[model samples]
Target: MTRALPSGIGLMPVRRPDDHRPRLDRLSAVPITDLARRFSAATPTSARDLDRLDGDLMLRGFAPVGTGVLRRILSRPSFFWMGKSFRRVDDELIAGHNFFTALGGSRGLPFAATIGPSVVDGRPAVRIDYGDPRLAGPRLTRRLYDELREIEPGLWLGPGFLRIGQRRVTVCWFAVDSSVGYGEVR
Candidate 1:
């Protein structure tokens, strides 16, 4: 025999558990027109040629070290919001992959991570990995860029070269659009 609840009592439906979907509150959608406008306004015509250097960091061979570099950089407070994984596809190669809220906390900064052969035609011409955040200051950005150029000249100044073990890596500087929620490096 089954027992019935009181007429005045209300029954609440049980919710089925599933894969956790990240809340959209943390993600901001910025208009493309606004991004373009800001890009043009900030960038100079002389250095505009650097715009073509954009793409994903394909970890085809250097998966371990590449992943380590990403992890190390993300560990910092500046890049705390940059999700773990890098860009997987090559659809609209602007600077790096569009980081869809994967890793980091609520206040985490959103940026792109790309590694590939080159930075040609804005498709990662060489094996380069870049992280650009909107929160970083101009001085900090310049300092990081200069440091990279000094430490790993091969990875930064030169074309590109693969590192077998745990070696120092370079993090390039890029511009971030807080209004729209995206970034791009020079």
Candidate 2:
């Protein structure tokens, strides 16, 4: 008979963050390659994880590599975007929208996206794609694709890519945490 080791025995004692804030801080300070490696190693966000994240998801933006001071500053919260709100539209598609705090937290520039399964770094991932004109506005904005992996329970990490002339370039690194509250967008 096969036997399983008791809990915490014959297993790696990996220390994980109690919350996403400290974890995000650590990821933001690491080299971009290290962050990508972590993302690559993380598990793909499962349907159960998305179901648990069906409300307003908090966001933390990390500056891309080689960016100047201003870009790094703008990557911080409340500067570029606040967070994203997600709702299950169908059995396989989750409708999503982004919110900003520019005018006292008004939900303006309401672009749309869909979170679905996709491949990233030759592995499975939950990709937020804005390629549908009906969902996302403007061709330029539609070229953005962000793939997410579940780093920890209720915490996800992803790299945002912008397609430019058939080439995808990494624009920024971001984290989505379902553990925090940021006032749902109406």
Candidate 3:
């Protein structure tokens, strides 16, 4: 039986890949979206093209590790939301993303992201933007562009700024390998 989906942002075509289907009996009761988001991640190839990325780091934002009081402030008060998995399919990049709710809880919101390959300041980079049906009216969701660069082997970084309402904050964006926190997330 097909259920008519509720209208809102971040809901997509739920025709997921085989790797995204169920496997764990322990988690059988969990919603398919939650389960799929956790299991659907891929790792990026160490190449210069965005189209070639099969998967990449599921970025978890920690305490802002940079200069300026604003950067610290932007990251401190809000709880961190991490996207554990990202994969490329037919030129589209899909992320298993979680978001911080204003009430201090976090939830996963599946959405499509657009990544453009380019050179920024002579460094290999890709410009990333969350596509339409975005999280609206949120401080972190509006007015943003993520510029991710290949910093090292198996490492990518997004040097981005976010505008929340009227205030803007420089965001610390970078993702480590999925194995970095395997025990914690898995």
Instruction: Show how many residue pairs clash in every candidate, following the order shown.
Output: 18, 0, 3
Q: Which stretches of candidate 3 lie over 4 Å from their true place?
A: 1-48, 51-79, 92-111, 115-124, 131-142, 163-170, 179-181, 184-186
Point out where model 2 deviates above 4 Å: 1-20, 68-71, 108-119, 183-186
lDDT of 1 by residue, 30-92 (tens): 232332333233322122223333322111011122355643443332332332122223342
**Residue-level lDDT for 142 in candidate 3:** 39
Highest-TM-score candidate: 2
Q: Which ten-residue region of model 2 has the weakest summed lDDT?
A: 4-13
lDDT of 2 by residue, 52-79 (tens): 5565566778767677684467445445
The Cα local distance difference test for each model comes to 0.25, 0.62, 0.37
Model 2 lDDT, residue 124, Cα: 67
31-150: candidate 3 lDDT, tens digit per residue: 333322332222222233554333323343322443445434433323243333455533544333433433333344333445544322333345444323433334445366455543
116, model 1: CA deviation in Å?
8.8
Q: Could you list the CA RMSD of all candidates, in the order they appear?
A: 20.9, 12.8, 12.6
> Pick by lDDT: which candidate is best?
2
Q: TM-scores for all candidates?
A: 0.19, 0.75, 0.44
Q: Rank order by TM-score, top first?
A: 2, 3, 1
Task: Point out the worst 10-residue segment of candidate 3 by lDDT.
Answer: 16-25
Q: In terms of TM-score, how similar is model 2 to the real structure?
A: 0.75
